[model samples]
Target: MRVTRSLTIKQMAMVSTVTLIIVSLFILLQLFHFVQQRRLDYAQQMESVALTIRQPLSEAVLKADIPLVERLLATLKLSGVIARADIVLPDNIHALHNEFILEKPVPALVSHLFELPVSIRIPLYSPERAMRGPLALLVLQADSARIYQFIRVTVATMLIAYLLLALMLTVAISWCINRLVIRPVRHLALALKTLAPEDLIAHQLPLLVGHRDDELGQLIMAYNHNQQTLGSIYNEMYCKASGFALPSLPNEALFLALIEQHSKSVENAAPLAVIVLRVETLQETHTLVTDDQRNILLITLVNRIRDCIDASCVLAQINHSDFALLITRDSHIFRTMRLARKMTRKLTQPVTLGQFQLHPETSMGISLHEKETPHAKELLNRASSAMMSAHYHGKNQINVFRTGNGDG
Candidate 1:
């Protein structure tokens, strides 16, 4: 819920910013065109009014009818379009103006911004049928006070309208994004709180509702897949790390699986052998050596057994004093005997036992996975039995399990 709130706020901010920008641009453009067109219409209307009265006004001025001239100008002013009307004599003295001011005057800024052409000027003609140039200059200026009022109102209206529009759009879009996108992600985050590696086999992560065919759905699927793979991944790492005697090998749990897989393969079914080596002198040297020396001797024995074989075999540490290896390639009783002797010879070498050099006595055992020894467990049992047999025979020895071996 908190994440949903945070995401909504961020999305709202972005939407509001974009809406404000677009609305501002649109308002400015419309206002610009409206002002230009209104001013043009105002100028045209004023000029037409002046043109309609041109003839009679000129005749009255020629006749020296000052009252008539005043009446014409007053009528023109009362039309409410012309702001001022003036008549310039030859010496340029007499001019008339509409001194009428409105109760609600346009603001000064609006007055300045919408200032029309100073005044439209027209020349008077003579009384002859043909035009003669001589009378007075007629001047008229348009009163845009109403147009200015409309402009002000239009600007304010647009501001209010766009502000409401932007607010509504921001709210709607933020809610949708939070519901569709953020909510699912929030669900995923909550689900991940209880998810772990060891719990994969026991628990299943809950999937998102109403989003089974989208990206979030794919993400949930991938998450469940990750949980599944983690079980095997952690298992593999544990197998590698579980080898205490030799750090690079697996313990019995993984080694048993390895042996089973090897025996199941058709190419590797040519009767493999499980060879185990036991440190016979370990119990006898228990009190004679410290824990550090005993561990060093065991580690050294495992390393020597590794040095005796190559990559064709699978080596693993079964327990404290027992190490197992699988002879997968070129495995027969004769070659197994030779490999066993080699392991026995290598493991019985002198080791540094804290200022004392002592030879570790080791016994090697071998059991082949034939018709009678089919299962991996049975093979390991016979190999262990042979190891016990060699342990009782001599200091360093090699023994192979026969058909009736390990029964005692």
Candidate 2:
């Protein structure tokens, strides 16, 4: 058996994938925002520390206060903004916190998303020294090792939360769809399968319980109405019609019902092939062979013809020696013509009827369906006319009728 995919699985995958993409975009945006905010806060703190120490360091340097310069540099490092500082005023001095600890570092790709400033430089001057440009430059490099460690801890925790949220959302969405939609549709299908086609009035589909006044509930009501209509219409046609009662779609008696149904279709599938196939030899067998033998042969031939079609089509015994095949699901009539040839081959096979051994002769007529003749009755008449024309031409003949042509 071929495995058909369930609606739930499809819905789950589609909904989950879309949601994950959205969540990922949001997380990416949030990461950029977090980094931007951290950069702003770091800039403010570093500037404040640099300003407070700039004057004292300048004064210390002007008075040649070596001890004061050391104290100022130490304070700048301890203030916790700059990772490493460098003072350049002819004698370049550097101070770095070698004890800075980072618990976890963010990946290079994550850190590169935003172009955050790595370091800043501040110029130091003293008016008291009567120096116009006699000053030092204070360079501060950011403590990214610590900043990224903070980001990593936050992101790791949020990633787990996001994963859990996505899983829960997928489950919730799939469950809701199955309960609200798929389950109801499945129930409707099961109900339809149990319905008896011949006696549709007695097998009314029960309305969906929770979906009253909704679209699905309305659909169920319409289905029950259709069943009643079909049953009553079939009963009426069987009682009143004078001609041969068409067998069901599965049997010829229901052929009129299918015609009635298809007549109402605007497209009714495609430009169909309405065919009238006459087994001239099968009809001749009625006179030469026993009724039982003829019936057996007819049944066998019908089954073979049924095998040629895979999709839904109407096949019915329209006459004692004739059958009608309506290919309503085809894209073109070429496949129907191929099927006709195959059926012709089946008919030509020799049959042993007691003492008589004979090969059946067949005459087939095909009419192309068009928007001008949407009714199955009209299409059939055209094909039947064509079949009669084929019969006039002699045995084993085929004739095709164009939609608008008067002379087929």
Candidate 3:
């Protein structure tokens, strides 16, 4: 799996949310279990205390002695289990009551005391009153310390667990996603970077993720399909738009596209090579040669030059005497000047079309395509400027485009 250099913010957020949810659920479960265990313990303790008070509470009710009942309630409270105790009479009278039974045994309580869920226990007593009277209702309450302790410990454990889980999840998800999504994308980006605008061929992207019925997979597939389609369209357009029979050189559209492609390629990438050639001393040769002879000479010269062009080369006539050549990066750009020299030398040889010596002089200029200006016209201008510079400097010379080397 590939890894991306960086994760998009949205992907990071999604991973974070998933991790947070898992951690939150774990914490919630822990807290709930603690609360449940705490409640069970408190219930057991309350039941025992209620049962313990049964006999004494019944005896106190039979005698209706408020003082004894108070003493018993105080002693029970001193045990520190119950928070509040109340013993009522058979007449439903508010009798002996010990309300201090509800306060905490410990002096320090957590500030969020009210946050703890409280449980209440009400005790019903049947006082024997000639076997005819209804029993009194007794009520008891106490701090849920056992339950609270469980909750406290549970919350602490859960908080720690949540923190640890969150950390683990963050690291895991970032790595997983980086491998799954980012890595593949980075690989694709590198491939795209390799693509030159001149590269009409389509490239296949790598499978970053194992094929899954997931959204990311679908997106990758769609993008790859689109690239193929676009590549096809580009090839068709270029084929129909850049080449034709050598004589006419097709229409302006074809020529312009050739220029644009070279220009765009230069802008997107490193410098390319350009050559400008103008027929010098053509008029002098044509003075003795007829119009038909001149036409044939120009046509023959263009054909000869075109023969030397490579696959990714463009040759176009800007005017009757000037032509432009665009080529991919060549190790020997100066070789083009040599080639032009050879062609001019061969063409300048005296031709006898019934006693006519047609000697043509050609001037050549070359320049590197760079990002500053990649337009075909701009490159052509530079080449033309260089050629003019060579022409004015000395006849029949080769020139290379350079900064401040304007045509004199």
Candidate 4:
């Protein structure tokens, strides 16, 4: 199986982000529950301590015993559960130990603002019915430092776990997705790169994926069928021709096919110009030369035409005496005219053929197709007519055929 390496990092990042969010929410919920539970437990412990010392605290306040009251308060503070303790008498007298007094009021205020202290006020009463009224009030404040520290530790532990879990999940999820989805797609793409009509017919292409009745399997089967059909059509068109040889340029069949294809497509609606170059003295030269010499002359003329025009222009040998050039409207009228004049001058120059030198007279006829035409045959006919008109005008002449023109 092909291993897909791309998109792994991106997929991992996406999965990690989602996992982190979920884990963070879960940890936050647990932290909130823990804080509330701690606060409730602290409140219960303070309430139980207040209840146990209620009678003693009430008697110390009734007797006006300062030392005894101080000792009772000291015991509550020493328990470590209470940060501060205060005694309030019925006469509106409030007393507290100096040891519990905050040295820096700012830190105490800040602590109170961040972590609320558990404050419990217990009312004391006498044993007699007539003394049912409260003797004193026991006020207890629980130290919140331990609770806040626990919360900090829990938060740090949760964050560490979150990081570890995210990393593990990213790796595991990326591996699974790469193996199941990305690997198959990559393999299919690699196989498609090697798929060609020729290779299909020869059975030379390799199957990168295993056979299955999935979408990918169906796609591969369809592609193979299409390749076979195209290969058969190509063989029928070019292979069945007489002598089974490739069509040479100026082959009317190939030229017509190109024109027909262009006509069917709107994007290729730009004007197409066909230029016919006729050698007036070719018939005379044919009788004076052998077949090899004729071939040499044709080759020389073809080369000269090629030198005059850009590579984009198509050059074709129409017959023994005529050659055809197909150019686009973008080639400009002036450029085409200059090229035609240049071809006439070059072909007329003296060329050494065996022991004799011959000067051939050539004429060019151009016909532009500005509007849609039924077929390429019509364009060829018009170009040929223009050439005949140039012949009438005399040797080395160039004529452009226009609609309603005498030549057209």
Q: Which candidate comes out best when scored by lDDT?
A: 1
Residues 1-408 of candidate 3: C-alpha lDDT, one tens digit per residue: 464434665677777788888888877776666666655665567667667776776677667767777776666665455666766556667676676634544324442443443434444455544555445556666565645666667778778878887878787878888877777776777877877866635766655557545666776678788889998787667655654333555334555567677666556554567677788755566576777877777777777777667767777776667777777655155665666666556655554455665556778787766646656667767888888877777666778877665542
- Backbone clash pairs for candidate 3 read 2-183, 3-183, 4-182, 4-183, 83-101, 83-102, 84-101, 84-102, 271-369
Q: With candidate 1 superimposed using the best TM-score fit, by how many Å does residue 259's alpha carbon deviate from the native? A: 22
Cα RMSD (angstroms) for every candidate in the order listed? 14.2, 21.9, 14.0, 17.9
Could you give candidate 4's per-residue lDDT for residues 1-408 as a string of tens digits?
454655666777788889889888988898778877888888888888888878887887777788987887777765666778888777868864424534223356536644667678899887564586787788888776666677779889988987798788878888897776667776767775766755655342334455456666666677777767877786666544411222245455666666556556634556777888898767678888887887777778777777778866777666668878887546456777787888899888877889978888987888776665636788877888889899889989998877776574
User: TM-scores for all candidates?
Assistant: 0.53, 0.50, 0.51, 0.47
Instruction: For residues 345-377, write the lDDT of model 1, one tens digit per residue.
Output: 777777777789887788778888886546788
3 or 4, greater by lDDT: 4
In model 2, the worst 10-residue window by lDDT is 95-104
Worst ten-residue run, lDDT, model 1? 95-104
Residue pairs of candidate 2 with colliding backbone atoms: 246-252, 246-253, 247-251, 247-252, 247-253, 247-254, 248-251, 248-252, 248-253, 248-254
Better of 1 and 3 by TM-score: 1
lDDT of 3 at 8: 62
Query: What lDDT score goes with residue 388 in model 4?
Result: 86
| TM-score winner | 1
